[model samples]
Every structure is written in structure tokens, then in C-alpha cells.
Target chain A: MDNLKTKHFTFQLKDLEISVELIEELARIDDSMPEYSRFLKEEIDSTLSLSQIEGGYTILPAQLDQNTIHIGDHCFNVGKSIANKFTNSTHIAIFTCTTGPLISDRLKELNSQGLILEAYLIDLLGSVMVEKAMDKLQAIIEAECTSKGVNITNRYSPGYMNWDVKEQKDLFAFLPENFCGIKLNESCLMTPVKSVSGFIGIGEKVRFIKHACQSCNSTNCLYRNSKNHC
Target chain B: MEKLFEQLAYCIEFGKINKQSPYPPNMKDQEGAGELTGQLLDQGVSADDILQKALIVGMERVGVKFRENKVFVPQVLMSAKAMDAAMIQLKPHFANNPGSQKGTFIIGTVEGDLHDIGKNLVSMMVEGNGYEVIDLGTNVKAEVFIEAAEKNPKAVIGLSALLTTTMNNMEKITIAIKKHNKNTTVCVGGAPVNQEFCERIGADNYSPDPQGTVEFLNRTVA
Candidate 1:
């Protein structure tokens, strides 16, 4: 605990150059539908203009005993799916990232105005942006670990892969109060709506798996359905 | 009249809102659902016919395409918008003829869940299919659903929850609705919900997509 350090990062909209191609693939639109493709591009630009991305992670010494991950004095029952992936992990990076509240506020406004299509496109863009920001954060963590000759595993969130979402409380305990300006409600849902939080394993024996969807049983997962595009 | 209905259905399927709507570039400058519906009404076609013969046909095609993965959310939303444009012209008729709807549907996201995109999509699809929809919005409680069900005695109740944690709330809501009225039909859906969870919670049905829900309602109520 004495050597553990928390690092925070703020990214401008320019930092996350979310590609239009990726957005189209996720939204299932293509150049053939030029009208919708153009609409999505416009909304993406507007959403990015309103987005304020922020993220941070705190690396802590961890010990895995079966399905339980012991970090400091807290133990997270992160379920078998995640525990199996982190079996060789010697440390864990707890992270949180958000695309601020403006995009959500704009979505509400669009919905109120009966622009459901535009609002839906913006919502999809927000999801893509926040995940892109997390990807950037992960790259930073990876580079730092690479410098130290430590490998990282694929990130896991509390709500996915059969892991009990209630463990979000335990996961948040590793971060400072309101880390990245994200707050968990009683139901463990993050506010600002487009925020994401999770853990990434760090150690020499840990390995990053590109597609965890094959082993995961949560078939209705949005990420699983869009992982190819992601 | 049949030609007009076919044209209107095509407009709804391709998402042509009006003569000015630039979608489905091939249909550009042609009168869309908005114009065609108005013409049908002025030509003495019944609102019920427009809904039954045109709007529902168009929406059903879109729903099937969505189920088959030939179309996605944005495309479906465009179709919904076109449906809305046509439905707007028939609003007065529906108001005067309350029994014109196929049936009533009550839907909401369970308590502790604020996600509504999936719920909204379901609502649009159901409404487009001629059901009178009563949307309870997000973070709705069991009592609210029971109350709405009590008012619309024959309405089918639909519960949605996007979070694994709120899946418990969906179960609690389902149990409460069933306890209030043992005969009431309850349908549950969401990203985290499935057939097993639906059966475990005693929910009457589970649909992975909006089309399945529409098909279930068609089978159950029709």
C-alpha cells in the first residue's frame, strides 16, 4: 500500500480521434446509406465537441486466491470468468473513465425534441468515445508496465462476464473518492451515463487476451456483439 | 386505394418522411408517408385501414429485417420516424375510435435502472404494430406497473432492465405484478435478461428483440 500510487489523466476531444469507420460499423451504417452515414458523422462531431474525457487508475499489489482477488485489505469476489483470466496476476490496476455529462444532457434534449434518431446516434457516439478514452488510458498503463517488463491482461469490469455488479463497490474502494468525477449510485450504476470502470491485471505471467467474448456467457452483452467493430 | 397503401408502406419501410425527406435516395422527391397518409385520409380511406394496411405492413417488414440483422437500430429508428409521421395524420381518428388499436401495452424499465434506449425501441415497435402503448419511462417501480395494469385490465405488461443488479428489481416487479393479478401476462426483456431468468422470475415471456415481443403480442392478443 505504501508504494501504490494513483495517476489521473484528462484528455481533450482531439486526443480520442474516434474514427468514423468504427462508428459506422458499430451503428451498422455504411456508405451505401449516405443519408444516415452523413447524419452520424454530423452527430459524432457535435458529440465530440461537447465531450470532456477524463480517466485514471491506481495500481495496487494484489493476490489471487481462487475467485477472490485480495487488494490491500479488500477482497473482491470478481467471479470465475475474470478470476481465471487473472490467475497469474501479481498486481491490479483499478481504473475509471468518463465522457462527462454534456453528451448525456444533449441526448436528453434531443430526445425531448423528438429527435430520437439523432439522440440514438449521439448515445452510440458517446459509448464509442468513452471506450476510446479507456483504450488510450490502457495504452498508457501498458507502456508504463512495458518499461518495467511486466505484462497486462485484458481489462475486466464488475458488471460483465458473470461477475456480480455489486462488486463495483469493492472495486471503487481502491480508487479515491469520485475518481474521474464518476459516482456509483446505490444500484452501482455510474453517473454521467457514459462512464466505464474496471480492473486490468499487471504482472510478468499475465497475458492480454484480445477476445474474451468467446469464453464469456453473457451473450446479450453490447460489447460482445460489437467487439469485432471495437 | 391498394396502390396508395402499397406506396405508403414502401415509404414507411424505407423511412421517407415527406417529399422533402432525402432518405432512400431512390425515393427522393416522391411523396412519403406524411403526404400519402394525408392523401389517403382526404380520399375517404379510414384511419384504421391506413394503420392496418400500410403502417403495420411497413413496420412489420422493418421489424423482420431487424430480427434478421439486415437492419439495425438507426434504420429501425428511421422507420419509426416515418411511422410517426403517418400516425400523426391519423391521431384524431384514433382518439375518436378508441377501439381501433389492436390492444394495449404497458412498458417500463424496472426500478433502479435508468437505461431506456432498449425500452424506447420496444415501445416504438409495439406502437407501430397498432398497440396502444403506455410508457412508464425509466426507474419505474412495481406499484406503478401494477397500477397501470389495473387501469388497462387487458393490457400486456412489459418490464425492462439493462443492469445485472437491477435484474433483481425486475424479478421483484414481476412477482408483485403477478401477485396483484394472477392472470395478468408479464413479458421481460433487456441486455442481461434471458429465457431462464424470465422463467425463474415467473415472467410469462421473454423476447431478445423488439420483433419477438411484437410476435408474442400478436400471438397472445390477436
Candidate 2:
């Protein structure tokens, strides 16, 4: 089950079908935004067309030695946070997802016009959209691994665990460039800015915790308290 | 007629662009900020009064509401658009009557950060509060801030950064601004910044939200 590569798979949930209800819930809208329901729906429809969802993953066999996880001849010196996460995992799935550049252009236009709130809402939507795509990708991966008698653990990203964000370059090396029309800059930040890149663990009888938000420093995140993960 | 200013303020607060705008459902087809400001000015109301009374007052209400989380981002954007509509009506008056300036506010997102939502929010709120805002835009270098301060000595410089990595540049910008002119006030804010970081970086002030920034300007820069 190690080094399994599942590339070029499409999404099940129609990208636009990601409920506006979920976006609203994530944005924490209340009664104060008069007529915002209609406004958000319009923006979502416009922004959804602008979004280009792309995701892919390749499985790699890993050998965890104390705190370091060696996969496909590359070693990750993850800290205690991630080391404990992959404890029962036998394989690792490296993944990346993005909503492409359109959302970013929309955000820029909103900001330049001093439409702060509109920009902020769209930014939240971008996160939700990317996550929505990732959720579908995860579901497919789960189904694939399930038939193989392997259990997949929760997904993990750098900048959370002691896994340094500098390691983002490492993940990009294995995936095809423009794998999802996403690219990394010198700073390791994915272009289009609304992209997500991370890894998931696969194992048998492994316990998976969706997210350890309580331990995360980003308390202001909209999704921090929702969906049992950050 | 006296209530024209009040009506203008209400229009601005509710994001009424014009009688044609269908927003704020209840206010549909009613006079909006644009129409109200034009009518008030034509009726001989002073631009200063309209600006200081209606536009500023309206933004203050929204700012307070935003601080209380009573209004979210979309609500604020509508209000800002309404304010812009009103500003268009009064732009000519203010252009010729520059004495109505409250003070200058030069703002930008710190270098290495492309994020500007917070910076733009503060810019609109501050502008609505009556400052002659000179927005430097995002990824602004410390030198640009200092240069702008040199050009407008009375200006209070605002530095914004949404990323933790870029937040570090706040200290450098603050130090540069202070070194160039120690009396020039430097305000900082964003998700990753706090009052402690502000003090550690030698910034003069820090606010968690845009309204607090306006209130800070009111108490200090005003």
C-alpha cells in the first residue's frame, strides 16, 4: 500500500453544489448583514465560475524513525505533532488542491476598490471551496484504500505540526507541475493564494483525529470550531 | 430640510446607493446617499456639514456595529459603496474647499504581504471618518511610508499585515518611521498582530479592528 499514486481523478460533488449554506456558516454571518444573503449568493455564483478546482495525490511508502518519516528516499523531520500522527500509518499520501487564479483576481479587485468586507467574504469562500474540493478528494482516497484493507488517517499540513512550511517544496517535487494549475514561489507560497497543499497518512487500525484545532495557534479561523477540525 | 443631512446619513448607513438600487429591500426606490447628498448640497447645505455630519456619522455607526460583530463584511462593503456614491456628489465641493480636511492618514500593507482586506477596511473606515486618506496600497515598503510622512508631516501612518511572516516587517517600518520622525504616529493592525507586538515593534498604537483604529485617530490624531 506504500507509494500508491492516484493521479488525474475528478470530483464527485459538483463544484458549484457546495452549499452556499456551508459558506455562510463558515463566514459566521448573523442578522446584521441585511440583504447579504442575496449578495453572497450572487458573488458565489460569479466567483464559482472563476474558480478552477484541481487536486491529485501520490502514495509513498514511509519508514518512521523516532520523529523523522522517510518516504520515497526523502526524509521529513516532523516534530512531535506530526510524528505522533503517523504513528500507526504504513503509507503516506502527498496531496495539493487549489481554486486557481480567478478567485485571487476577484479578491484583488475587491480589495483595490476598498471593498474590505466583500474581499474578506470571498477569501473565506476561497478557503471553503478549496476544502470542499479536498473533502471530495479525501473521500475518493478513503474508498480506494478501504477496498485495499487499509485505513487512512486524518490529513495533515505543514505550518501546523513542527513540520516546517519550508518542506512545501518537497511535496511539490513529486506532484506534476501545474498538477492542479498551482505553482509554488520562492517563498513556498502557492500562487493563486487560495491553494491547499498537505499530506495524509494511511494505515490499518489507525485512529484518526480530523483536526486538533485546540492546539492550533490560528484561533481566529472561521472553520476552527466547525466540522471538528481546523 | 434640516433632516436632509440625517436622511443622507441613513442612506449611507444602510448602503442605499440611489433610488434605483434594490438593496436594503425596505429602502428600495427611496432616495439614497447619492441623491440625498446632491439634494442637500443644492439646497445650500454645507459640504463640511454633510461630510462631518452624514458621511462620517454613518461610517461611525457601521464601524461600531462592525466592532460589535453586529455587521459582517458584506454589510460593511455595501455601506462603503454607499459612502463612495455620496463622496462622488461631494468630491467637487471638497476639491475646491480643501480646508475641510480633518487630517492626513497614510496607510498600507507592510512589505512581503499581498493581503489588503484589513488594510482596505481601515482605509475606507478612516476615509469615511473624514481623514484626507493617502492609501499607499499593499506590499508598501517602509521607505514609502516615511516618504509619505515627510510629504504630509501631520499624517498618521498605518501599517497592516495579515500574514505572520510579513508581520515581522512592521517592526522595521515602525522603527524607520520613528527614526525619520519620532513624533509621527504609527498605527498597526491585522490578524497576526497584537498590542504586545505593536509595543515590541515600537509602533505607537494597535487596534484589533478598523473602528478601534478610527477611535484611536479621533482621540490622538484628531
Candidate 3:
């Protein structure tokens, strides 16, 4: 029974260099805002610290419920809206990428001292850095899995498409303890405020689907119009 | 004197905080909003004119950019910071005389939602636009919002929630505010909130961005 196992991945800071463009995108600045670039560069050089952690699971044969999927000795009531995405999927990968606690702590300090704007901006940069780290992680997975002749789908996280946030505990259980020093509190929020957790689907025919913002129930998300990011 | 106000407005619009700030490369080492405000006051520009003519103009411009997605969080933040530094000098003037502020605003992220990024941005934008923003910080309960509104009877209350779960509390808070006093204008916004959610909760309105919130509040008191 223990032979059914999960693969883990960790990344070094230097291996993940968050690009200026990504930070700018996260900041939501479409124009060439020179000042934002200046501040972001300073933040990346001084305040930013990235740690990437990911875990993958090869699905075990199991049946699906109207709102639940039984796979690999675990069952997730992933809701009908999200289960629709998994119809043709064979395996699912769960991962978390964080900018570590350093940036989050610093943001709080900035906020308390009345540096609300600067703090909020840096917080956006942290999110972008974490996203870049995830990209690198996905690349590593794709390189290894390509030889296996399997296709990977875009990542989906909880709190979207009726996949309740409480299901985060089920997702985390498949990974190593305190994987990359990330933890979920009572609120299902990751310890590092900039951290993200999500699942990716793999199948022979699954290609990356363009995120359909309209299809998503959360119609008012700021990032919905810029759907490529998710 | 007019030139000084113009300079102050420009400094704030571009997020030139002070002479010491090195962010906006074009304005590096130049007198920013902070220094220009002090100089304008020293030259006898009234606090009301400085706020109405300089700071409000800058904030309104940034607000429009934010709504259009031309300026992101960082740019708005820089402008907010410059506005804050300038406000440090103007606070004393308003303290000595009443009615200097256009209105009072109380804002917070709803309970169980630790996210404050959105709330902070709105608070800064509202404050920059000549309102007195009382930020209750993140994870605020309905009672806290109600109490604050009670203390400042005419204050406009804003509730923010980034989490879908926490958005439920916004509805509760709005009902409590209306119950406490029907006239209080309670506005709501966040990633999970929309116009439908806003109206369902009986809130006065909803804004997608900070500038939109400022515009809504401006119209309410105008």
C-alpha cells in the first residue's frame, strides 16, 4: 500500500529570478511606469526571498461522484463545477509556492508605519515572485512528464469554481509535512500570505485550456480580465 | 503661489514623495509633494485650497488611472505615500479648525479575512481625496464597524472581503449598520464581491477599484 507514493520538488532562490515584466504585470501597470520598476527592483534585491515547493500524485483508478472524486486512496468532494474539468484527467498534482515569511512580515511593518501604499505594492511583487517560482516548478514537471507522453492542464486552486477552501487540508495531506515550511491556519490561508496552492490535471489529451473568466463563478475578480495570469 | 500648488499636484500625481525619495527617476532629488506642501503653507496657501486645489486634484487623476487599469497598485501607492507625507503638515491645520475635511470615512477588511491590500488602497485613496479615513485595520467585526459609525455618526463605512467565506460577514455587517442607523452609507468591495452581492447585502453600492470607491463617496457627499 505504501508503494503508491508521491514525488516532491524544491527549488533554490537563484534558480528562480522573478522577471521585471512579471512584477509589472502583477502590479497591474500596463504603461511604462518607471517608478514602479525602480521600487520593484529595490524590493527584489532587498526584501524578496523565494522558496518553491511542489508534490505530485499519480491517480489510482477510482470512480467519481456527482460532487466527489475518489482517487489514490483519497476522496475529494471537488464539487460539480470543478469536477467538470477533471472528466478526461488521469492524475492531479498539488503544489505550493511562497515568497517566504520575510516579505509578508515586512509588509505588515510598512502598513503599521503609515507606508500603506508602498507596503501594498511590495505585497503585489511578492505574489508575482511566488507565481514565477510556480512557473519554474511547472517547467520542471513538464520536462520530466513529456517523455511519459502525458499532457498537463493549467493549475486550479481552491475557492474557485465551487472547490471549497476547506478542501485545502485534503490537498495538503498528499504532500510532505510542512512542505517548504508552508502551513495552513484555521482560515485555510497559507502561512506566508504570498503563498499559493493549487492542483494540475494530467492526461494523454489534456492541453492547456485558456482560462474562461466568464465560466468562472467569481465574475468580479480583478485578474479575470487578465485571465492569462491564472 | 499658484506655481507651488501646481508643483505639489504634479509631485503627488507622479508619486514624488519628498526630496529624499529616489523612486520616480525623473523627479529624483526634486522637491516632492511633502516639501512642496510645507513651502506652500509657509507662503500662506490656506489648508483648504492646498487640499482642494493640489491634493484632491492629484488623487482624482490617479483614481481615474486606477479605474482604467493604466496605473496599478504600486503607482497608486506612491501617490498615496506622497499624499500622506504632505498630510503630515496639513493635519495640524485641520486639528486647530473644524470642517477642514470633506467628510469622515471608516474602512476595514471584514472578519475572518486577513487580506488588507484592497482595504489599505481604498483608505489611502479616500484620505488623499480630502476625507478623514479611520482605518480599523484587517479582520474587523461588524460590531467594530457599527461602533465606529456610531462614534462618527456621519461617517461613510466601507467593508472589504477578499475571501468568499468572509464575504458573508459583509452582509451581516451591512444589516447591523442599517439597523443601528438607516441613513449610514455602507459600501462594499473585494475580489469576491460584486454589484449583485452589494445590492443583496443592502449596501449603498460597490466599487471594483479604490478610485471607484472614492468617486462614489465623493458623489454621496457632493
Query: TM-scores across all candidates?
Result: 0.93, 0.84, 0.82
> In TM-score terms, which candidate is top?
1
1 against 3, candidate with superior TM-score: 1
**On residues B46-149, what C-alpha lDDT tens digit does candidate 3 reach at each position?**
89899999999988899898788676676887898889889999999999876888899999998777898778888888999999999998888889998899
- In terms of docking quality, model 2 is acceptable
Ranking by DockQ: 1, 3, 2
Tell me how far the alpha carbon of residue A123 in candidate 3 is from the true structure, in angstroms, after superposition: 2.0
Tens-digit lDDT track for model 1 on B140-206? Answer: 9999999999999999999999998899999999999999999999999998899999999999999
What TM-score does chain A of each model score against the native chain A? Answer: 0.90, 0.88, 0.80
Error of 2 at A193 (Å): 1.3
Question: In model 3, how large is the Cα lDDT of residue B126?
Answer: 93
CAPRI-style grade of the A/B interface in model 1: medium
List residue ranges in candidate 1 displaced over 4 A: A1-4, A34-47, A218-230
Instruction: For candidate 1, give the lDDT.
Output: 0.88
Root-mean-square deviation (CA) per prediction: 2.3, 3.9, 4.0
Model 3 DockQ reads 0.34
